[model samples]
Target chain A: EAGVVQSPRYKIIEKKQPVAFWCNPISGHNTLYWYLQNLGQGPELLIRYENEEAVDDSQLPKDRFSAERLKGVDSTLKIQPAELGDSAVYLCASSPRASGGASDTQYFGPGTRLTVL
Target chain B: AQSVAQPEDQVNVAEGNPLTVKCTYSVSGNPYLFWYVQYPNRGLQFLLKYITGDNLVKGSYGFEAEFNKSQTSFHLKKPSALVSDSALYFCAVSPVYGNNRLAFGKGNQVVVIP
Candidate 1:
């Protein structure tokens, strides 16, 4: 079985430019998530989706960050007018479903490294 | 709110020796814990999880974690460490239900000396 897939494994953009990362989760998975990992740090969740609905995105910077999971299979995380601090690895993950308890394991993509200069 | 804490910033162990990486968590409800490993330039890989029942859960790559409810800790352990085991390890926790959001610890970098 194929694992989660992400595009543009590396990205470089200037501050104030727009950047987007794409994610295609494992087929049949209903829960998708977007996370950010800074250097020497663990993954921090930016958004979470249960199908097409974003159930949690409180951590996302609403002014510059936006995400969409259309059709509940593929997802896109976007950053408008990016800041240098936005430079980090953007990771996407998916789980089979959300109805289960929080113990469910999430499969992760290789991630896209975003460098904002 | 749920949160995870990995006390060590780095752990060094010689190959073939035992290894342990400590982690603790705080949650309002029953805790659902997980351990993930990340190699250089790669995303996080699931190592193990503790939901209920058994305190000791074995997972991929000969990795195991002992869940101590009394101490609110879940430390990753390996009997015989391998050089390949060198990587960044993260501990995550979440409540039994609600938002289903995961709270991750800063992470522990493991270095296995060969």
Candidate 2:
């Protein structure tokens, strides 16, 4: 089966511009996650979705960042008025968690590299 | 709060020799640990995980990790290193189940010289 897929592998935008990244999780997977990865650092969770419902988004910057997992299959992460600090790689991941077990390993996509000027 | 720490920024090992990458973690209750590898400009690939049972857990690409509850460490190891094994390795931890927000360390760069 194909792994997680994401679009716009790279994005370049000016400060205050709007930027968006898209993701499509593996078929039949019930959970999806969006992560922001700064240079030389590990990914930090921005939002998580179980089906179409966002179960966790405590870390998301709601002031200008928003996400939507429509139909529980595809997801979009958007940032309005992007700042220079927002320039980073956005990673999307998914996993099959019918049992919600910790053994379920998350599979990741290539990720979208966004650069804000 | 849960957190992971990778003491080394880089680990160099001669090909065909054993290699080890160290990781330490702190979490509340039982700990669920994971190791992931990433190539340049690519996403992370799951290497292994420790949920329960044996402390020694084997995973993809000849990688393995030992869960030391006493020391709060889950170090990744390989019996014989290969050039293809060179990559950035991340150690992550989750305090409980169904919480996908795994606290990850900065990462360890592994270099295997042929």
The candidate that achieves the highest DockQ relative to the unseen native structure? 1
Task: State in Å the error of residue B39, model 2.
Answer: 0.2
lDDT tens digits, residue span A1-117, model 1: 999999989999999999999999999999999999999888899999999999888999999999999898899999998999999999999999866636789999999999999
Docking class of 1: high
lDDT of each: 0.93, 0.92
Residue-level lDDT of model 2, residues B1-114, one tens digit each, is: 789999999999999999999999988888899999999999999999998999999999889999999999999999999999999999999876546468889999999999
What TM-score number comes out for model 1?
0.98
In angstroms, the error of model 2 at A88 is: 0.6
DockQ, all models:
0.81, 0.73
Which 10-residue window of candidate 1 chain B scores lowest in summed lDDT? B94-103
Off by over 4 Å in 1: none
For model 2, what is the alpha-carbon lDDT of residue A43? 96
